[model samples]
Structures are given as C-alpha cells and as structure tokens.
Target: MPEVGVTYFAGTFVRHPLTMAVVHAALRHMRANPGLQEQVNTTAERLVDRLHALLAAEGFPMHIGRFGSLLKPEWTQEPAFGELFYYYLREAGVYAWDARPNYLTTAHGDTELDRIVEGFEYAVGQMKRGGFLDDVRPTAQLVTLASDRTSITVPSTESQREVWLADRFVAGNSLAYNEGLLLTLDGALDEDALRHALQTLLDRHESLRARFSRDGRRLVIDHHLELDLPVHDLSGLGEAERTAALERLCDEEMGRTFDLRRGPLIRFALARLDERRHRLLFIAHHAVCDGWSGAVLLTELGAVYSARVTGRAAELDPAPRYADYVAVERHFLESPVGQAHREYWLKQLHDAPQPPQLPPDRSPGPDPGLSAARVDVPVDAELVTRLRALGSAHGASLVATMLTGFAELFRRCTGQDDLVIGLAAAGQSFHGQGQLVGHCVNLLPLRLRLDTADGFADALAITRTALLDAYDHQGVSFGTLLPELELTPRRQSAAAGERRVQHRRARRRHRPRRSGCRLPHAGAAGRDLRVVHQRGRHRHVDGAGGQLPHRAVQRGAHPRLPGGLPRPAARRLRR
Candidate 1:
C-alpha cells in the first residue's frame, strides 16, 4: 500500500485539462470566497463528478474508491503538488492540510478519492477562519488574448536561413551554429532579483521569446511568451569544490545542443558559489544570436541586474523585435546595395585560390563534426608590442597582421602561394541593426595571392590590401555567398527540412558562423587549419582533429606567427 500522505494524479499535469481545471478552480474559488463553504464544496463536487463522467466516457478508468481503502495502484500519476500542500493547512491557513487529495492521475486509488473530498471540506472550514479568506485579491495577471501574448511569424533572416540549411545538411549532427558564454561575477548575487532581470530581458526582446520551425519547405520563426530563466544554488559547496563544479557545469551547459526546431534557443544559468561570488553562463544557438548580440545581452543584463537590486527600473533602449530584422533583411537582400555587395564577393572569390592544405593528425573523412580541442599559443608582452608597432607602420591593425601571418602560414603548409581565409566582420554597419539580438555577422573571404620569394613584410602588405578591399563588400551573409559562388554545403545525409543542395565540388571557401576561422572544405581533399581570435586571445580548435589535445598548439612553425602584428614591428618580428 502507498504511504498514507501520498498524493496521486490520473494524467500529466499539463496534458490533462480537466484535472488542471479542478485544481486551479478549487484554489481560486476557495481563495476568493471563504464565506461560501457549502457552495464551494458543491461546486468542487460537481466539477469532479463531471470530470469523472467525461473521463469514463473517454474509456478511462474513473471508479470511486472506498474511504481509506487501498485499490489498484495503476490508476494514478502522483506526488501531485496539490496534495503536498493539502497537508500544509495551518490553523488559520486556507488550504485543507489534512483533507486535500493530491492531483488525480491513473495511479490514484480509492483512498485517494476519499482524501480529496475530505481535505477540501476541512480546508474550506479552516480557510474560512484564516489566511486565504483575507480580502487581498490574488495577483492574477489580466491579459487579453489579442494583446500581450501575440505570436508573430516571419521568414528567417538570410543568416538564419544559412545556418538552418547547414544544420540540415549535417545528417544527425546539430552543431552547426550553437555558441555559449560563461562570465564569473565577483561579489554578492540575489537569485530572485537575477531571475527578474532576465525576465525583463525576455520581455524586452522578442527574439528571446522565439521558436524556429519549418512551415513546409519555408523556414519561419514564431515569437511567443518569454521563457523562464533557470538558476541554481551551489553556494553550499566549498570554494575549491564549487569552482571546479562550476566549470564542469558551464562546459556541460555550453556543449549541450539546442533544439532549434522548438526553441527558446537561449540557455542561461547563474551558479551561486558564495555570498560574494557567482558565475553566470549564457548559451544560444547562432541562428538567434551572433557574437555581437552576446555582448549586447551581457551589457543589458548587467544593467538590468544592477538596477533591480537597487530598486530602480532598468532603462534599456527600446528593443527592436527580431521580426523587424527579418523584414529588413529581406528588403536588403533584394536591394541594389545587396546586389552590388553580392557582385563584389562573387568577383573576389570567383577564381579563389585553393586554401593551403595542412596534414592533419588524422584524415578528415567529412567536415561536419564540432568536436574540437583548444590549442593556445602564448605571445608574451614583448611580441604584442612589436606586432602593434609593425601594424602602425603599415597602416594596418593587429587583426590585419594576424590575417597576413595566417596567409603566409597557409602558403608554407601546402606549398601554395595563393590561399583564402575566412574572416568574420560585424554586420552592424547597416542602420537599425545596432541593437537587435539575432544573427547579424558578415563572413568575408580574404583571398591572398602570394609568391615564395615574398618576405613577411610583403605578405602583410598583401593581406592589408585584401582586408581593406573586403570592407567594401562585407554586408552579405556568408550563406548567401555559398550559393552565389556555387559552393553550397553538401548533405552527408538528408531528412525533412534539409535544403536540396546539389552535390558539387566546393568552389569557394567556407567559415564557421561565429568563429571567423577559415574552415577546411571537401574541395581541398586535405584539412586546412583555422584560427579564432576571441576576447584578445587566439585559440585554435582542431576541426578534423575532432579530438584536439588538451593543451596542444596546432600552430605554424613560428610561435609568434599565430597573431598578426602591425607594420614596422612586422619587420622587427620577422627577425
């Protein structure tokens, strides 16, 4: 026999409408009218009787159980929340502590039914004398069906279309564009306030309340109510233990795949390590957000969190809904500027030189897995200064020098003088794109034609020119570039929602969405190394080397070659 205080339910709390109605209605009606004990009981009984009839008519088992007698244990689905509270009746509380039955499920038996009615009757009498009967109205939000919870549908932005198509081509792999961030905050944190701040963001940004799904062959997104933010308490653990556990948690959450098909797409966690320290992590699929958007989220979240703790409302700028981006994206894709940019990319990559091939630790059978190992090659302060000096002399910045160095690295690896690398540029140069949280990155191909006789200085010069030229046509989504260059990603496997890209040899270079690193493609038949510069650090994730060494540096012969240094210093570094 089940424990005496156990509660049971007949169906899922969410799927069973009648059970939900009975529970909610009982609580609401009882709270609103403590004087009408007899009427409340009558109403509850009538509701249960009608529910039983409806359930029985639907061929479900709904026989009444004997008082305090055990029946078959297969009729309920319990530990109903209501029953747990049924026993929470204080002498002056409205809830029927000893008499309320838990939720109804298929596993519930006779004793449960008797308890439900008894609990309701006793609770009504007690509540009439106390807590819930007090005249403060319940905080029920008044929302119109047509206003607050509006669902807006729109076509996916070109960037979304790009990743969605790539995801489809990966057979069963869902790693096309998922990205994450983990920030450790020093000082105290209030979880309740944190949750509220996050909720504020969700309310302010439509994309946060969005889901992506296919409407037949066309890709679309539907915006709905904001997702509930999740927080965890690990403040009880030791400082040392909690820090380790926090890292593991961050990894697990970041690596965890998102279901873009039915998405909140964004995942968040605030691990409370101690009263003075906390770690906050945010993970989102690239389709809903880009690198720039991630920073925007953090800045806004910080602003909101601070304002909340101090009792001030956050004055975030009016959020531009994701739908607006979709409309704007569509307009640009058909505009003259878009056409002009498209022409530039097409011309730039038309005869794109094959990327330099590097012998991988293993054969890259296919280029679709996200399993990666991080390789960090350190550059001391001296090297950084020299690189900056070189960049200044050449009228190029450190990023340009890095790009130039990478071009030289490729040439050496494959004995090829001409090579192409991918670079990610912010797509915010356009008006109205300054604050939206969605995919808005420009992936531009930096093609370099070199000669073996060219010195490091000459290589930087070529790279600097290419970088400047790239600025002219850096607005188009890289996904759009693929089709334009006849380099659509091939499907390793096919299923519903997969775009039919003709299996053709890749004619242009490809880059990962957020990681600006030039990706190795099937056209080369050999792996090409990629370099990702993030947060002032250059980390290489082994692509084909799906299993990157824990601390291996898959770098070129020159350790300082990893990052591009600026101009006259470029000459000094060459030494």
Candidate 2:
C-alpha cells in the first residue's frame, strides 16, 4: 500500500524511455491505413489499435521490460523482483534481497512471468485462508530464494581433493563429471506431495545444500539460507512427445557443466508420461555426490515421498555429511598408517613398467585431442557360463577371468604378453563411511604378465593375484600415487597430473553416461579398457579410441563394428 502521509519515505520511479516511441509508431500506422481508423467504433478503439501497431518497433519489448522500482539505503536489498511492490512481498513473506535494480532483462519471458504469477496466487490463497483479505491486502510477488549467505567451510577429503584436481584439469566441460539418475513412477503421482518430498530430501542432506568456492587452492563449502526447488509438470505431453522432450532434457542436463563454486550443483525434473506414469530425474555434480550417494538419496526420497503421499511424518534418520568424511580423511592422511600406505605405493610403483598403449587404428591425427565414441557388442550367454566355470576350475574369480580375456585382447593388439590396465573401486571401506556424500572412488592399476605358452586358465590366476594385491592396498588414491609412477616417453610430464578417472565400463560399457570416463584418445597404445557385463554375455570395449588389433578382430565370435572391427563377445553369461 502506498503511504498516504509519509515523509522521507524513499522510493524510485523509473520511466521507460520507449513509451512515446511506441505511441508515435501506433499513430503512424493508424494514419498510413485510414481504413483501420474508419473501422474503429470510437476513439478508444482507435487508440487500442494504434497501441498494438506500435509494439512492433525494434527493442520496444526490452524498453518496456526495463521498468523497475529502486529503493533507498534502508531497504538495502532488492525485493523478489524488479517491479514487484516491496510491501506486498513483505506481507506475503517471500524471501529475497539484492543491491541491483533487478531489471526484467531482455531474456525474461514466460518462465519469469509464470513464476511471478504463481507467487501472487499463493499469496492470495494464504490471505483468504487466514481471513486477512479484509485486513492488510496482499499483492503479487515472484517465487525466489532468500538472499542471506551462510558462512561454512569444510576440509577437503582425500577423494574430494582428487576430484578437485580432476575438475580443474578438465575445467569448463560441464556435465563432464555429472551423475544422472532416471526413475520412473509407474503410478499416478501427487504433484504437490512430490514437491514437498523433494524439498524434504534437499533439506535432509547437507551436501545437497552445500556450495563450494576455491580460496586459491583450498576448497571452501557453505550453505544457502533457503533453496528454491521448482517442480515442472509435463504430464499432459503425448507419449512420443514426452519421450523426445525428456531425452533432450537429459542430454541438456548431463552436458551442462557445474560451477563447483556458486553452486546449485544438483537439478531435477518430472514428466508425467500419463495419468499412471511419471518419470523423475536427478542430476548432481560429482564434487558433492557420487554413485553411492545417489543410492542413499533414493532411499531417503522413497521414504519421504511415501510418507507424504500417505500423510505421515517422514521421520528420516540424520544423514552423514560430506564434512564427516573430510575429517576422517584428514586424520587418516596424518596417521602412520597413511604414511605407510603411501610408502608401500611408492615402493610398489618404483620400478613399475610404463603403461602399455594399444595399437592405433589409423596412422595418427596431427592434432592431439581426445574424442569419445560408444559401441555395444553382444556376448554369447553360453560362453559367459563356460568362462565362469573355467574360472572356478582354475580356482580364480570371474572378474579375474574377464580381465584375463581382456589381456588376451591386449596381447593380440600389441603382440605383447605383459600389460597393465586401471580398474575402478569404491573406496568406502571404513565404518560409518557408507552413507557419506562425496567422492570415494579409487583407481587401481593391475599388471598382468601372461606367457604365450600358458593356457588361459593359468593367466587367470596371475590376473586374480594382481587384482587381490591391489585390493589389499586400496587406501592410496590414484591421485596420491600418480607422482611415484613411471610414465611412457610419449606421455607429457604435465599430462602426468591429468587425472583420467579411468572407470571400467559405459554397453550404457555397459557404464552410466555420467561415469565421466573419457574414451581413450588414440595414443602410444590403447589408453584404457571398459568391460560390459550384461546378461550371460560379456563384451570388452576399448576406451582406447581406435580399431581393434587384427588378430583380436579375427578371434572375435559375434558382432563387428561398421568397418569390420571385431567386438569381443561370449555365448554364456553367468552369476
């Protein structure tokens, strides 16, 4: 409400510079077509026609969009929006503050308009419910976040530090390290209830609320006062349209990178496939959440959503904060055990052979940049069963057998019996660490030496031993051990610091797209390997960005790439 007798009540009124231009343009259009004026019943009708005509002038929308209210030092903060009345926002209790004019920028459109309209409707509903319409009347405002900043700083966990380094190395590639999860609700969902549940989940996890800022090399994390969790409804979309739109949304979400600082590192959306089906999406920056953290998130969301739909208190247990892991990691790094592990790693890698590169597909590219491509090769279900039995017969594990097969592909490619490939492991082996949200991944370089004379069974044993030994010394992060490893002559010294997350899968190798494993750009040899264990069949795909070795191509039993490159396949898949 405007103050009737207020003195020193500071406020600002901004005039749109283009108001007269539009009025003049409308009048000119009217004059140019006298017939239009003759058709109008009255002067008011003619003016309305002239007004619509003037709206076509270039930059006119932008000029009108600039209208906003400025305030004195006493307000100190920008209200919910540039032009919204401050008193109304205060009456409705919408949180907002800013020093800027909050201009409705040229980019603002239906998204901005809808958000403001929703806030207004919500405020009116509140007024009617509280019998306040007869009292101080509420006015329109826009949905927005509270602007109060929360001061929070956290120590980086060993895993977090590793991720930070990798994040920096591959800077500006958004979605480069994002984790995407798609869930389908096969029943009708209550939109209001689901939004409540999602908000509860966001509030439940501190990591979800966390934002990171780099203070030089050190990473700092802080919280936001209130987060805006907007829910989108696309339930009315036709099945085909919904599918296409959702695919585009997934790609857009997965590919957009996050600023670890200035964070809203996670995002979500919902599409109603029909009255009976709804799909939910969760995309989170890897710095704060990992695969394990996602599992935890789902578990909690399920409880929250269930209780909400049925009108019960969620009553979820307190979640472990990422900070907790940072504290544990700091102590571990300072302990004698940590030092011993580091020493063991250094000694282990002291005389380690350089990583073997897979033979290139073509001669080479003049440019030394990386490119990624994905292909799936079906494995024979029966062959997979036989391979498992073969492992059992040789007293070796199935994974060991698979690695042995992969090594054969390597041997065939390079005509060398000895090679080392990195495999991934979840490093949350300690007590109370299972539920923490943060990076807890470790990459292990498993070296295998197979004699051409030995049977496949014998090679499996060696691979198993290498894998088990690496498991025993899993505390040292791949980042922690990088300085101690020998590198091939072709490898750049600076590139040694490049932390390729080197995950072992994508048949979707059969690794989630957000696994963040870069397909090995063709180099001194094949750079990495991916194994897809699906059904009874196992397909070994190269992260090395090239064609398979000639002999391996000839040796493959089923499916081939377009150019006749052999795809590893088996007949049997097993437990």
Candidate 3:
C-alpha cells in the first residue's frame, strides 16, 4: 500500500476547529473592547516618534516603519546595526528579535513605552561608542534550535568543558567534581511521597539525565531514564549507632565517583533517623549541577513531596531546559556578540600581572594536589544586616562589600598593590536561564590595584565597578576566554605559587517561597531563621582547578579563622 502524500496528510491536520474557535473568541473580545486597537496604535506611534528623535540626535541613517501597532526598525547602510542594536537593547533590559517587527498591544503602557525608548537610545549610543557604526562589523548569525525532542547532541558548554578538564586533572579521584547537599528533615517522613518527588524532579530537569560520551567531546541527554531513591533505614539502630552510620554514609557518598560515560550522574539517598527525624542526601556530578541548582533542587523537591503527601497536584513552572542553554552558548561563540565580548575581556586583562605568591601553611606533599581545610564561623544576624547596609552605602551588594575586605587582606598578606582574583558567577543572567539546572556557572577575573592612599570607600567603589563590569560581559565562559587571551593557568603541583585561597560566601538571606512544606531551622521547624555556622574552605590550587574553598568569619572569633577573619582582628592588622 502507498502512504498518503505529505501535502494531503498535512492539510487535514490544519482543519481543527479548536484553533478557529480560539481565534473567533479573540476577535469577539477585541470587538467588545473597541478602544484596544487605538491604544496599541497610539503606543506604537509614541515609540516610533521617540526612536526618530533618537536617530536624528545620533545622526544615524536608520529607518523606522509602522503600520498600526506593528513597527519595524532597520539600518540602511550598516548591516551590523541590527545585531549590535539588538544586543544593546537586551543589555538595556529590553529583549527583542534581530531587527524584526515589534508588535505593541493594549497591555503595553506608558512605562513600557518609556523603557523601550530608553533602550533604543542606549543601543544606538553603544553602537556608536564601540566603533560599530563607523565600520561594518560581522553580521548576526542564526542559531539552530534543538526542537527535536527525540535526542539532543551538542558541544559541551564552557562550564562543562572546564569540569571535564578538572576531572582529567584529578585523574586518581573520580569524585573530584561531585557536589553534595544534605537536608535535615524533622517530621513524620513519607517514603512513597519522597519517591514520587524524586521521580518528578528527575523528569523535570534534563541535566540530571545528562551523560558525556567516552571521548568527552559531546554531551548527550537521555530523555527516558528511571531513577530510584536508595533508602537506608537507620531508625532501628540506637542514636549513637545511627549517627556513626550516617557519618560513614556521607563520606562514602562524597567519595563515590560517577562514570561519565555510563549515566545517572545524580544520586539520592534517604536515611530515616527515627519516627520524627530524617536525613536526605543528594550528590550530583558538578558537570550536571552547580551552587544555584542545589537550591532549585531543594525547592522543587519540597514542593513535589508536599503535594504528593497531601494528595494535591504539584504546581511548578516548566523548567528551562539545559539543551536550550547549550544551543544559545554555541550561537554566542559563533556570533559577533561573542567577538565583542572577547575584545572586551582581552582589553581588560591586557598586560595583566600574575597573582602574588602566598606562602602555604604547610610544605609540599606527595598526595594529590587538591587538599583543603574547612572552617565555620557563626556570624550574628545583626552584623550581617550592618554589613549589608555598609555595602548599600557604597552602592554595592553584600558580596562586593565582602570582596573588598578579602582583597585588602590578600594585599596585606602578599604586600602587592596590583592583584587579579577569580570571582565566581552563577552565569544565569540571560532571560530564560535563571532557573536552568546545569553547569552554567562562569568564573571572571577581577583585577584591582590598591595604593596606600586608597581608603575603604575607594576600595569598595573600585570593587563594585569591577564586579558589575565583569557581570555585564560574563556571557563568554572562562574556558573559552582563556584560550582567546593566549594564557595558560599555572598548575598547582604541590607548589605554593599555584595555591590561592578564594572566599565563597553562601548567604541565605530569604526563606523559601510559600509552599505547603515547612522551613527547617536548626532548633525548631519554623522559628525565625538562624545561621548555624558560616563555613569557608582554604585551598591551594590552580585558578581553573574547579574546586573552590570557603571560609567564614564568626563574630568575636580570632582574625585567623577561615572564610574571613574577625572584623576587629582585621582592623588591628590594618592598624
């Protein structure tokens, strides 16, 4: 038998009444709201008028056309204007297609119109400043969409490539790229509900089901993979026995290595402490997860578990897929935007000085190069608030404020005025990537010069500017950036110069969003939040070693603590 022709079979599928019915309803609604069209047209005209003024002021040969509420913008002479303008608009908080027609609706108000005009101005100004207007840069390139749900294979992201390199670096330790989180639950546990929650999580996040090929050249994601939660019931044992067993389990899980070629990069184990307490442990390969993903996992797991136990449907927004992120990154590297970013980074790090060599606390050893010690200092909530205020006064974030303190201390330690420090970023500043679960993090080099005449406020301002600039151009990955800059990070083979301690601040200022699940605190289930201990690690490794040590400063503690020293001790040292 012969199969139906493509046109004949496809024609029937378009005759569905549901689409027509929706269109009819929309038309009816529009008829009822007779002023909708007028409002949209008015808004569009206002936008066009603003753009025309901006174009005339900037003296650019750009054309703007409008029919009713639909508007189109184009450059008559320069082909790169569209691409450069689109990116600049995006940077100015306006997301638009590459020189495509823009439609305005009744929903758009004056505020949005103002923002659009401002964005246009900013884009034009940037294009002029970048010398793009003077010379035609590369035209924008199109990116392929991974819409085929059957299977996806794309080149690994910069973050994933870095992880792969580190995994190879620490060849003996397979668990070098593992990230784990332990959540202590105090309630009547539900094993069935937990299992369902785990399944839902795995189904929602594609990164958890990701696997790299043996050659480590490509990342392959398997859409169909069933994962079971391994439960270890330690409730039968005595408190002491259960505690010891749990500790051993933590070590084992931490030490367990994943086979990147096989599959199942994430592991979940439930240990029931007793009738009222339980410990949930989740370990995932760093290739598949990051610091931000941990919070996402916890939030979603909590929501699903609560809904399943309570016999209600889980309410979750569809997660942004990792595949989309990979495709976008690939497109970026191949586009003019990527080239611009490369230029910016190169200029920023031109003739950059090497990091000062700090003396290691201990001598060299034959053991593997990655060794670190963790220290926890419990910071008072009041002091945290004060620190935040201090940062605000300097027009910076808490992290930036803390970074200033860290840089100053390092300068004092090494007695170096010029320094380059690696700052960790979540790398999710894109519109759809905030909730993505994957290795999308990027490390940016923060270079600062401190002089004896510089004060605290000067340092803070410099740090804030450097941090903000880094974030603005953080689209390019460090792995890709290093090669472009023609630089190689020194290896830390038990060498003091290769060892540097970076401070990673893990601050949870806000509680989880409103869900049925209760927040777990140290003492009670839902009392006011309290930071039990601020922990940080000190490690000596290469900049791209993939392992970041953390240290925290507890109130009233000695200045020599990890994470950070006490404020008084730091001040004393400064004096």
Off by over 4 Å in 2: 1-149, 171-174, 215-219, 224-238, 363-371, 378-384, 451-453, 486-529, 532-575
lDDT by residue for model 1 (425-447), tens: 66654644777777777666666
lDDT of each: 0.53, 0.52, 0.64
Model 2 C-alpha lDDT per residue in residues 1-575, reported as the tens digit of each score: 33465343223443344555666777788788776533432322322223223322211111011112211111112223323333344455533342222323223345544554454445434434554433332222111212222233555555566666556664333334666777767767787777777787676666776655443233334334244544456667877887788776666656666766656678876766678776777777776776667766676677788898888998876766666766676677678887876776677666555444445456545443333333445767665666667778878866776667667655665566766567666655543466566566666666566764376657777888877877776666766776566655543332242212133532232233332222211121213334444445344343332333332334533344212334453332110
The digit string of per-residue lDDT tens for model 3 on 1-575 reads 23544442212357543665677777898999998888887787777777766666666656465667877664434444447778898999988887566788777898998998889888878888887776543221111111111234556877787677667555443554677777787778888888889888888988898877545766767545576678888989998999899877877777777877555789888888888888888888888898778778788888899999999999999998888888887788778987887777788876666656553334445532443333233456666667677889778887887777777766665667777776667765543577778888776666777774267788888888888887777777656756556443552221122443444455342124342222111110110011121322111111222122222122212354223434421111000
Give the Å shift of residue 274 in candidate 1. Answer: 2.0
The collision pairs in model 3 are: 499-540, 536-550, 536-551, 537-550, 537-551, 551-563, 552-563
Ranking of all candidate structures by their lDDT, best first: 3, 1, 2
- Which ranges in model 1 have alpha carbons more than 4 Å from their true place? 1-148, 215-224, 365-369, 486-529, 534-555, 559-575
* Alpha-carbon RMSD to native, per candidate: 17.8, 20.1, 20.4
TM-score of each: 0.63, 0.62, 0.63
Please say which candidate is ahead in TM-score: 2 or 3. 3
